[model samples]
Target: MKDIVEQNYSSSQYIVLIFCRLLIGWHLLYEGVVKLMNPNWSAKLYLMDSSGPFKSFFFWLAQDKIILPVVDLLNQWGLVFIGIGLMIGLFARLSAILGATILGLYYLSHPAIIGADYLLPNEGSYLLVNKNLIELASLLVIYLFPTSYKIGIDRLIFKKHE
Candidate 1:
């Protein structure tokens, strides 16, 4: 097996990266848990509110009786798995990628383009960038500059190989 190269990061950098990982993970986990606990919770309203180029696709996802349930289950479990994986530093890179993918879909569904409006009011003004985009970028950063192998559960698990 090819060896993994070690990269040195400053203490502050490590702290910030780890903090971002944990925070995003917690946020995803909370969202998944809330949806799971609420039996009536569905993505219909949100998907129906989509206003971007992919609006039609989102609407279809929310409207299709057969696919809707599958989508809901995947969203719920995907969030839970990705969140836990990130929080625990197990498959952190993969988790970040998946998290970013979900965020990307959300961004596409409700892009902050000119003249675009959403039923959900924006807490802050945005031109072409919003919280989802920002979080996606953060996840990308986490994926590129991974710390899991150094300080997360990955460290313990992968240590044997190293």
Candidate 2:
């Protein structure tokens, strides 16, 4: 009876983990595809012009004159890579970390961009903190649970290395 119960619990855990991975993966993949398809789908205008708390910060960044290009490239490539990684479950942990990091930066850049008002309750900007937090949590779960066992190429690669 104890063994059976333990087995059931383990199976349930895997199911939940896989579900989370799939959900996040699909979401990221969709975002990447959208951005890739839209050449003018730039966040620069929002980050730099939006009347939000981080507007000034983004403005400063834009005018930094040194890191603007690098930041722009990072933003563009980061989204695409993160989306691809999540979708394929390749180096999922690394992808998750990178995604979370990017999200975190966005959150810091404009905590009010989404709807976050805890710190400053106002219809200012979009508060991306929630999104970042959720992504970070999902990343942690992916890192700990490793849902690549079922449908990811990581399995074959890991086996080969072994």
Candidate 3:
């Protein structure tokens, strides 16, 4: 079966998809930049505060001095790269998948299940659904619809090959 859906989407559909992509990209980029700018910023607290079934693994990742640095670097850079790719519609599908994966990891580590609490306060209350999951779903939709090649940098990049 084909992975990406191919269709002649209406202008409105394209507009909505592009809007979503840009918004998500901006959010990711902002997060990455904030982390990058702060020398003291680290995922240690967040990982240590994890409360899901994978709590042990996340805690291990946070406590490991060697691995922690690598993890912090990858997380920050990954967000930046993914955000840029999505914003410019360059390798958008890959960006969407990567974004979803990162968000998935976040959601798994801090699930919004009942009675679960964390050191980091949530902006809103949730129960089994939250912004991370919503954003992850949005990325999945972006991946499935894939409008970058039609209206993004991908258009120029892939047009030469086509």
Candidate of highest TM-score: 3
Once fitted onto the true fold, the runs of candidate 1 whose alpha carbons sit more than 4 angstroms away are: 1-5, 160-162
Whose TM-score is higher: candidate 2's or candidate 3's?
A: 3
Task: For candidate 3, write residues 5-114 as lDDT tens digits.
Answer: 34678999999999999999999988999999999999999999999789999999999989999989989999999999899999999999999999999998899988
Worst 10 residues of 2 by lDDT: 1-10
Query: Local distance difference test, per candidate?
Result: 0.88, 0.63, 0.90
Candidate with top lDDT is 3
TM-scores, in order shown?
0.93, 0.69, 0.94
Candidate with better lDDT, 1 vs 3: 3
Candidate 1 versus truth, CA RMSD in Å, comes to 1.8
lDDT of 1 by residue, 62-102 (tens): 99999899988988888998999889999998999999999
Backbone-clash count (model 1): 0
Q: How close is candidate 3 to the true structure, as a TM-score?
A: 0.94
